[model samples]
Every structure is written in C-alpha cells, then in structure tokens.
Target: MILKSPFPAANRFVTIQATMNKTNPSKKQVVVIGGGVIGVCTAYFLSKKGAAVTLIEQSSIACAASGKAGGFLALDWCDGGALSSLARTSFNLHRSLAQELNGKEAYGYRPLNTLSLSVTESENPSRGRKQTLPDWIDGPVKSQRTIGTTETTAQVHPQLFTRKLVETAVAEYGVKVVIGKVKSVETGGGKVTAVVDGGGVIDGDAVVLALGPWSSKFTLLSSVINVHGVKAHSLVLEPRDKDAISAHALFLSYQQAHGGQPMDPEIYPRPTGEVYVCGMSSQEDIPDDPEQIEPNPDSIRVLKRVAGTVSSHLGEQSQVKAEQACFLPCTDDNVPVIGEIPGMKGCYVATGHSCWGILNGPATGAAMAELVMDGCSAIVDLTRFSPARFVKRRR
Candidate 1:
C-alpha cells in the first residue's frame, strides 16, 4: 500500500506563492547541503511547500548516522527542557507520516514497549523475580522497569524512512538531488548566491547547512556555528527464531565481571527480524570524510559480548550481520542549532541534533520551510534554537 501525498500540488503552490508574493521574490530556489535525514527532510518539506529544492550530498543519501541509527522514537522522553516542544511536535509528525506513508509496515514504523535493566553482582535467581521480563532475556538481568509504553514510544528503520522521504519528494515534486562535495558557499550582496562544489556551482536563493558532524569542516560555517561529533559503535544481528523475540526496547546498565566502569548498552529488536545494539561513545576526533569513520575492534568485541549476555538468541556470533560506527553531531550545550544565521543572510543551519536527529527530522524540516518562506516557523517556536545564540556568545 502506497501512502498518499500529504501536500497536494495545488494547495502547496497556492500557499507558497502567496507567501513569496509578500516578499516580491521570484521562484524560491533552496539549496540544502547534506543527504542525511535532516537535509533530506529539509528538501522534502521545501518541495512540499512548492519551493525548488536541490539537495547536495558528499556521499549517498543516509550513508551515515541516518542509516546506521537505531530509529527509536519517543514523545515524552525529551520532556522537561527546551527540547520538550520540539520533541513533542516531531513525535506527532512521525505518527502522521506513518499513516501518510501507508502505515507502519512500509517503513518499519511501530510502537514499542521500553524497559530499563540493571545488572548486579549477586547471582541469586531470586534477583530476577523482582521485575517482570520476557522469557527471551535469559541472562544477568538483576532489575527491570518499564520506562515507556506503546503509546509514547515507537521505532522506524532509519535508512528506509530517509530514502522514502527523498524518493517521495522526487517523484511527487520536482526536487533535485545532486552528487558532489560542497566546498564552500558563495555570497554576494550580503546573501548566499550559490553553493560551490567539486562539480560546479549550484545557484540558490537560500542555503541550508545540514551536514551533521561534517558541517564543522566547512570554514564558512565553522566560523559561525560550533558543532562537533561524538562517535558511537553499534551492531545488527539476525536471530535464528526472530518470531520468538518480543517487541521491546531494552536500556541495559551492565556491570562487567572484571570491570571498573559500568557499560550501558541499548538493544532494539526491529520489525525487520533484526536486533540492533549500541553503546560505547568515544570522544574521537571527527573524520574529514564520512567514509573514513571506522568502528573500534575493542568496541565491537565488547558489544558482542554484551549481546551474548542480554539474550540467548543474540548470543550466536554467526548471526551478526553488520558491525559499524558513526558520529552524532553535538553542540556545547547539546541543543540543536536550527535557524538562519545572524550575519549570513539567506543562510540557515540545522545540525547538532546528536542522537535525536532521526526522531526530529520531519519537524525540523517543516519548521525550516516555514522559516524560509514565511520568515518564521508557524508550527514550532524556534527562538531558543536559533544559530544566532552561538554567534552572539562568540562576540
């Protein structure tokens, strides 16, 4: 079942044209840099709003964290902070998109139950009886607590969802995807005129830098926004009897038998018959190239060992399908930097999402489109997330 387009052509064109006429601008040409979830979603929303969008990528679409991430979605997980509103808005958009994309089956979208587990030194079997756990989790589970219910939490196959958004934008609208590494942004008359890459210059009326951690590498942007990367390692495993595994996400705080520090590993059993486990963050320097990102052998070994202790099905090393690592973008304060830069007219940025990039991609895109066309976001209030905050502190 194919999902219907939420933004009909006639309505989109009318709405965008009406907004553009207010500024007396010609056709809206938007150039989005990066092909991760954030960039693709920005391009998708712009196209939905009847803007001419060109998405430029150094590598293939979703080739980094957007593809490798464990696509866990939570509505209230990020509450009690500045991110509360943004997280809530994005969670709702995800629910709507699941239906608009022909239901959860299409993109591996589904509600999940989440639990928190802690390991203990005591091997007494009575320790396991204090909390309820699925029969499949047959290891050193000392304590378990339900953290989220199905109504509040969900999951998606990150790569599939990212690719779908770009595909839909291309087929339904006329959005363009260009393959090239953006070298720099060309500015004139106090506004961005075009993006210069290896191939050639792609002109645009507006430019968005959404290059994840790689955004910092561009001197033009690094001088303005302070974004860095936190490297993480993960593994995808295929269980022998996938049906036996329950649809529950596990956040395990493990105590290694011979260890000093406790290792926290997360396990998510996907609808696609695969289990994803991730933990172990490193302060390693960000690579200049996305393809150069590599997983530490020790990290992988530790993860494999943790998986074996988590569940019987995941114990088989032969079931391991992929072992990988990627860098998640972060800011000094940990809040995302999303909005137009103060000095760089027509230049916008949407990165530093860290682990929540995939979960909040759609809302960020929608808000960005509104900011670009209507001069402010009509959906979510982005005053606190403006890139100007970083620029002001530097002065």
Candidate 2:
C-alpha cells in the first residue's frame, strides 16, 4: 500500500526521516512551536513517533487558554459537522491516554453527566432539589435535560493535562522544552529554523507551528489563513461542602432578575472539588502577550452572579479560587487549518480550533505526528482540513 498526502511537495521530510530511520544513526528532528494544548500534543506525538523533538513556548506550559478553558469533552457535540470524526477520535484517545498517564490522578480526568437547563434568578432561592438536580443546585432552575452521559462526555483539568503530556514527552521520549518568543521561521537550506526574539535558533528536519491565537501574529500563517481570537471569561469556586458537588457539567441559559439578554454559561466540576463556571465570550483583539490578557470586570461580575444564581453552595458561601480569561482561536471558515503550509515544504501549521482545542488535542497531535513522519494520517483524513483550500480561495 502507498501513502497519500495533500502536502505532496512538503513530504520531503518523509523520505529524509525514513532514510535516516533506516540507515542513518540519528533520528529525524522536529521543532514544535507553541506550548498550548495543540502544540504540546503535537510535540508529544512527534516524540512518540521517534522524532527528536524540541517544544518552544512563549510562556509556561498550559498558562493560557489551555489552562483556563473549561475542559469539557463531548464525543457528539461536534457531530454532524466537519469535526465529528476528529472529536470522536480524540475522545477515545483521551480515554487511552488517561490509562497510560494515570490521568485521573495526575490531571483530574473523569467521566461526567452533562445537562442543559434554564435558570431565572428569583429573589428567593429554592431550598429543595428539583428535577433530579444534585441537592446543591438550589437556584431557580428549570427545563433540565440530559445532553450527555458518562460514556460520551468527560473532562480533564486542562492545565494539568497539558503539563502531564509535556512531562511524559520529556521523560519517556526525550523531547526538549525551550522557553522563548518565536519571532520568525527560516526555511532556507533544506532545514527549518525557529528564530526566537533574543536571536536563539532551533533548527529541525521539519517544523509544526501551533501558535493558537498568536497564529495571526506570525506572518507566515496570517498570510494565508485568517485566524482571530475570541476573548472569554471564567471563574472557579471552591464550595464549602466539596462532596456536595457531583461530576455534573451544566450548560445554562440564565436570566438575571433584571433581565436583558439571556447569558449562556457552562459549569464543570473538577475531581479536586472545584467548580469552574465560564461564559461571556466575544471577538476581540488579542494582546501581544498571554499574561497580559485579563478578565473584563463586567464579565467577571456577571459570571460570579451566574454562579450564585445557579447554586447556593457556589454563592456567597463559596471561595473564589480563580477569576481569569483567555482567547480562543477561530478561523474565517470556522474550521481548523491542519496541513502543510501550501508552499513551505517540511513546515506545517495547526490552529483555528476555537472552543474545541482541549477536546480534540490528542487526535490532532496524533494525526500531526503521522502526517509529519509517515507522510499521511491514518488517524483522520486531512483532505478537508488542508491549508490549500484557503490558498485556493485567495487565487
């Protein structure tokens, strides 16, 4: 059987890596830029495939969206769309990765039930649990329905999950981690080099750019793909009765007492006994630095109010553990760009995952590994997600 690739010209590394793996003593070297879930996953899978990998990051691992976003995984939420196969593939991969990495202990991985409900804050909170809600959801909740179950919906502490992948990639596969702000890429002389702001260069047989929302900041990608950021805010609450919280993720349509527009916030309970509530997302200009991204006071206030209105345990009695925000990378066509850059052989790109980054990280990484090393991805078809489509639009 022969392998097929959408990136025909860019498969130079395929033969080089194959020849090197066969006769040359040294393994193929791959430089992966970005430290978010996508980049970390790519590096992890690349190293697993025997590539000598170096992961470059502008900040600490999982310090941005990967760290802050609600780690909600839905096997079918993205079904009936282009991401259906990818979501299903990654959901299973998460399960296997959990077993291999002891994810439950290391990253708070667990299956949970997901619900969609409507809540209208009243002057008085309900004292009794209704509609089979866990006793703690004392808010004026109604119209509750199960959207997902343990078999299909699950989660991981996103920050810990990304870090765990990095740790495993380093300890088990000898992948190196580099801290730097990548300024540009050099594709001259048959090698790809990542030039850092301070004049540091990391060269490799191939390179994968997973810059998340920062993809637009990189001229190489922005020249072809239109990647933008959506700023989203979230808050974490530590309820006094931790045990009262069950592994139930909630999708809420909330209307405050003085209602204007209904708000859609999501709630996820971590195994470590913290409840994370996130909403209030909008398209915004991304800051030059991730650390500089802070939550809007109004958005934070609204989310805090939503938490209290949803559950008394999460109301004034709960501890405000974290109030933060991050940007979700979106694309012009609302699909991820995940193939070799049209004309840059031995250089690839992966971004524009939007809100599905964490849910799809593992499979994305695995497919990228296969695409970079094996010349094709058996994990998922890359035809629909090829960057060439966007390039074609430009013609």
Residue 174 of model 2, lDDT score: 79
The digit string of per-residue lDDT tens for model 2 on 1-395 reads 01112112222121111111122338888889898999999999998999988777776778789999899999999989999999999999999999999989999999999989888876455533365887777788887899999999999999999989998988888777766677898896778877776556667789999999999999998998889999999999999999999999999988878878888999998999999999999878999888799899999998988998888889899999999999999998899989898889999999999999999999999999999999899999988889999999999
| Candidate 2 all-Cα RMSD | 7.3
Q: Which stretches of candidate 2 lie over 4 Å from their true place?
A: 1-25, 123-129
All candidates' lDDT scores? 0.83, 0.86
True-vs-predicted CA distance for residue 88, candidate 2, Å? 0.1
Clashing pairs in 1: none
Instruction: Give the clash total for candidate 2.
Output: 0
Estimate the lDDT of model 2.
0.86
What stretches of model 1 exceed 4 Å from their correct place?
Answer: 1-26, 120-126
